[model samples]
Target: MRAIFFDETDAQAVVARLRADGFEAALERERLAGEDDDEDHPWAVVSDAPAFMLEVLVDTHDGWLDEGDDDAGEHTTPLAPLDLPTAPRTVKRPDLG
Candidate 1:
């Protein structure tokens, strides 16, 4: 998932635009960890900073979308996992067989 930060003011507009353009976009209003809400959280999930910021989460697969059915607001398909690159780690090699 990619989080593209945009100016707070245009967050909603951007999200709407992306949705219209057949892209996966959403406004993150709260932290899922159940922590105390901080001042950083935008009241409307949109910012009013110098510029509007948007977090664009690209779909890893077409499955994330609802099979392209024409039903409005009918999200039946499950959200697919985002493609992520494997972390790089060094492993010591033992004696070869």
Candidate 2:
């Protein structure tokens, strides 16, 4: 289960509450692409809590909850190739005469 909150404080508070209730909850900060400011980022709550409990908690806090696969909403991008030397090179020593 997962939820997103626009406020960090609220997210943390929820996480605390869930922990107090014996739920395995974790908080994370998410910043989407093209968002340059830290204030624009949102906080996320991930938990192994049941649907009923999650629903109640989210409803009580007026938060948006997204229930789906654990990896849902995660973005993946391909890595670019880099050009570099694959073998060691030897350098000749200069005479000091």
In terms of TM-score, the best-performing candidate is 2
Cα lDDT, model 2, residue 62: 70
Candidate 2 residue-wise lDDT, 1-97, digit = tens: 7888887878888899889999899998876679999988888899988878878877877788886565753655546888889998877678843
Tens-place lDDT per residue, model 1, 1-97, is 2233324545465566657656566666434355575645442232222121232221211111122243434557667899886997777778752
Query: What are the per-model numbers of colliding residue pairs?
Result: 8, 0
Model 1 alpha-carbon miss at residue 66, Å: 25
Winning model by lDDT: 2
- Runs of candidate 1 with Cα error greater than 4 angstroms are 4-7, 30-37, 42-97
Clashes of 2: 0
lDDT accuracy of residue 24 in candidate 1: 62
